[model samples]
Every structure is written in C-alpha cells, then in structure tokens.
Target: MVSVCRLVGLRAVARHAVLVIALGTGLLGAALVALGVVLIFATDVATVYFDWALVALGAATFGVSLLGVFGSKHESPPLLRAYASVLLLLLLSLIGAAAALSSLGEARIDAWMEEHWERIEATTLVVRKDQFEALLADHVAALLTLLACLVLVLTFDLLLVWVLQCSATSRHRRLRGEDVERKPLRASNGAGVELEAVAP
Candidate 1:
C-alpha cells in the first residue's frame, strides 16, 4: 500500500512537471514567432530566409508543446517519448548551429555585420557608416554578455529536456509494472486453466 501510494504521488508530480514543460515550450514558441515577425517588419538585422526559419521553428515548437499537453493528459508513454525525442533533436540542432557560428571567429562575424550594414545604409539614409562602426566598437561587451546568456539558456533547456525524458521513462516503467502485477493475478484466479480446458 505504501509503495502504491508513493507511485501515485510520483505520477502526479510527473504529470504536473510535464504540464509545466508544455507551458514553457508554448511560451518559447510564441516568443520566437513574435521575434521573427518583429525582425521581418521592423528591423533589418535578419534576412528574409532567417526570418522564415525563426517562424517555422516557432510553429514546430508550438506544435510539439501541444503534443506534450495531450500526451500528459492521456498518460500515453509513446506520445511523451515522441515529444521528448523531437525536442531533444531540436535542442541539439540549435547547439550545433551555435557552435558553428562561434567557431567562425570575431573577424568573420564582423565581416558579416559590415556587409549587412552596408546593404542597410545603401537602402536607407538613417545610419551612416562611421556611426555604425563606432556603434560596433561599443557593442562588443554587449555581444559577449548576450553570448553568456545564450549559454545559460541552453543549459536550462537541457535540464528541462532531461526532466521530460525522465517523466516519460517513469510512466513507461509504471505501465510495465502494472502489467507484470496483473499477470500473476490472472494466474491466481485460474483463468489460464479454464482457457486451457476449453481449448482442448
């Protein structure tokens, strides 16, 4: 009885955790979509291709969050597993992209920024080349701070994914345990003997 109560409590806690993960993922998706929209219309920092990628990523994230919600509601191990796997893949891809970008070094990043600034300056009279160069000089510290924040956020996301996976695994184990328990109960009731007699 104690083990059963403990199992129930753990299951409840796991369900609540999964719900929180779904909410977090949904908010993340909405933020990404909003950022993409803002960038596409109000800023020249991102190209059209990059803007679309952000929006697509947001949509996929929101969809996965919905999957997690349903999975948790139904206590379906398979759906939860699928949700965790897709989220893990997305996180890994983001990490890889970040790694590749960082490996390009400051010179490559500066060149890319200069190229974009020139394109923006050509199209608009608001920003001058000298002013942009000065701005870049001043923003180096800000850029580094942003990089640090990104690392922290990635670490937090990894922990969230780990929690989600553990919840799925625990649910699966509970299901298997229940099945095993039922098998012995079935034999204790002599149902197998009855079935065997009928078969013969």
Candidate 2:
C-alpha cells in the first residue's frame, strides 16, 4: 500500500511538472518567433542577422518542446532521451561560452576600446589612461554578467530536461503495468534477504 501510494503521488507531481515545462517551452519559443518577425523588417544588416538567429533558435526550441510533449503523453523513452541529450549539449556550450568570455583576448579588448574611445571622450568631462582601463574592465564585467545569466538559464533548462526524462520513464513503466518498486523474492526469508530488482 505504501509503495502504491508513493508511486501515485510521484506520478501526479511528475505529470504536472512535465506539463508546466512543455507549456513554458512553447510560450518562450513563440515569443522568440514573434520577436524575430518584428526584427526581420529592419533595414540594418545586424538586425537581419539577429532575426535569422532568433528564428532558428525559436524553431529548434519549438520542435524540441513538441517532442517533449508527445513523448510525455506517449511514454517514449527514446524521444525523452534525445531531448535530454540536446539540453545537455546546450548546457555544455553555455559553460564553454562563459569560459571563453572570461578569458577574452587583450587584442579584442584593445580594439573594442579603440572603437569606443571617441564616444567616451565626448561624453566625459575628464578622461585619463586609468579611466580608460576602468571602462574596459567594466565592459568585460558586463559581458561576463550577461553570459552568466545565460549559463544559469541553460542549467535550469537542463534540470527540467532531467525531470522530463524521469517522468517519461515513470509513465512508460506504469503503462507496461510494472511495479514502481519491486524486489525479487528468494527461496526462503532468512537472516539476510538477498535483494534484487528486475528494473526497467
């Protein structure tokens, strides 16, 4: 009875969590698509590039969310695993990006400062070498902060992917009418009940 109750409770929680994640993904993808469409009409080439990037990301996210929804509903282990794998890759790439940004090249920093120096000079009443160095440091810090936010988001998404996989596994086993928690029985119950499970 305890096992049955625990299984039921877990399934209930997992089902709701999966639904929330699926819905969130769908909404976020849709928003990105909308943003891309808005940017597509811009005259600037940079905006055009950004639009395409957003569109591609939105499409991929939409497809992944579709797979997640379908797999959760149908209890497909392969689909769930695939989704998890992709999310894992995203997390890894975000980590790599953060690392790269933290170690950004001095040449690149110098070039950026060179480009912005005129603007900085015009805006400031006083400017010195130390002030320029401080500005460069601040810009680097800002970039790192942005990358950190992205990494956090990726980490959270990966966690949700893990939950989705577990939910799919649970549903699959339950659909097959397998016990949620089962231990193999031995010939006789002695001082030591050698425990083993035929887990899926």
Candidate 3:
C-alpha cells in the first residue's frame, strides 16, 4: 500500500511540476550559454552580438526557473510572487512580439525578402520570386501559429497556478481568522459604537 504522504494532491503535483520546469529551464539556459560562447568566437561580429543577446535572455529565463522551483518547493510567498510577475512580463512580451510580427505586413515581408533575394538566389538560383515568397510566407505563418499556441498554453497554465496559489493563501488566512473584515458603525454623537458582521 502507498503511504499517505506518497499520495499527492493537485497542489502537490503542481509544486513538483515547477521543480521539473526549473530543471529543464536551467538545462536550456546552460545550452544557450554554451552556444553563445561558441558564437562569440565566430567570424561574424553581428551574429556574435546576436548570440550574446540570446545568452542574456537565456540567463534571465534560467533565473526565473530557479525562483519558481524554490518558491514552489518551499511555498515562499515572495519568491512565488516574483515568479508569477516574471511570467506575466514574459506573457506581455510575447504578445508584443506577436503584434510586431503581424504588423510586418505582407508588403513589408516581400520587400524585405526582395532586398535579400540576391544572396538567397546565389544559393538556389532556380527558385522563382513567387515561389520563394510563398515558401517564406508559409514558413512564417507556421512559426507564428506554433508560437501562438505555445503562448496560449503557457498563459493558461501560469494563470491557473497563480489563481490556485492565491485561493489557497486566502483560504488559509480565513481559516486562521486573519481574513476577517470588520465593519465599524458609529453614531453621530460618538457616544456609542456598533460592530457590523465580519465577512471572511
């Protein structure tokens, strides 16, 4: 028979999941840092700088994962709040990125592609403008669609966890009678005081 402590509740599962996410995030961040180190030695200055930026972003993500893992495991309010705030910021940033991408309309995409067509054609001369455009369009669409799905899933999961945390906290507070809201009713003469019902 399984022990009582071995049987986990939804909250327990969520807490463990946070640690798992943290582990994965940390690994990804390490990989990015390694990649950035390699890229920094590349001959292309611009590409090296771009890789550095990715490394920075990866480091930030890794930090968030650490905070999330610690918060979830220890049930630390401050850490949990910080993790939630970071997720919110990431969600907003993703939305902004999506908007910016969408704003790069078809005309802009075509124009941008045309500007680089010479280099692209040098690699595959047989590719026609229309065909290349169509392929690029499809590729971009697929990427955006996948990213949108990911964002939606992340948003839902994070929101659910945050809500659950807040609800659990409030429930505990109420149980401890610390969540009682006392309403004061005083007479105009200030001779008497009335206490209204306290709602938790």
**Which RMSD does model 3 reach against the true structure?**
8.9
What TM-score fits each model?
0.54, 0.58, 0.63
Tens digit of per-residue lDDT, candidate 1, span 1-200:
35754877655655666677687878999899999899889987756467778989898889998877877777776776777677567667656756766677668867877778766665543556777767866776676566566556545544544555576677679878877666633223455462211111
The models' CA-based lDDT, in order, is 0.69, 0.68, 0.70
Model 1, runs deviating above 4 Å: 1-11, 31-51, 112-200
How much is 25 displaced in model 2, in angstroms? 2.8
| Candidate that beats the other on TM-score, 1 or 2, i.e. the better one | 2
Q: Tens-digit lDDT track for model 2 on 1-200?
A: 35754877654554455556766887889888887877677534333245688888998888887876776566577876787677678768878877876776767767777888766555532456567677767787787787788677657655655766776677667855755344354453575666555554
Q: Which candidate, 2 or 3, has the higher lDDT?
A: 3
For all the candidates, what are their Cα RMSDs to the real structure? Answer: 7.0, 11.5, 8.9
TM-score, prediction 1 = 0.54
Query: Among all windows of ten consecutive residues in candidate 1, which has the lowest summed lDDT?
Result: 191-200
Q: Write the per-residue lDDT of candidate 3 for residues 1-200, one digit (tens) a residue.
A: 13532586556666666667667777887788777777668634334246678779778877888887777777666777888887788888778877877899888988888798876665534557788788878788777786697588568647645854775576567756753454443344465755454443
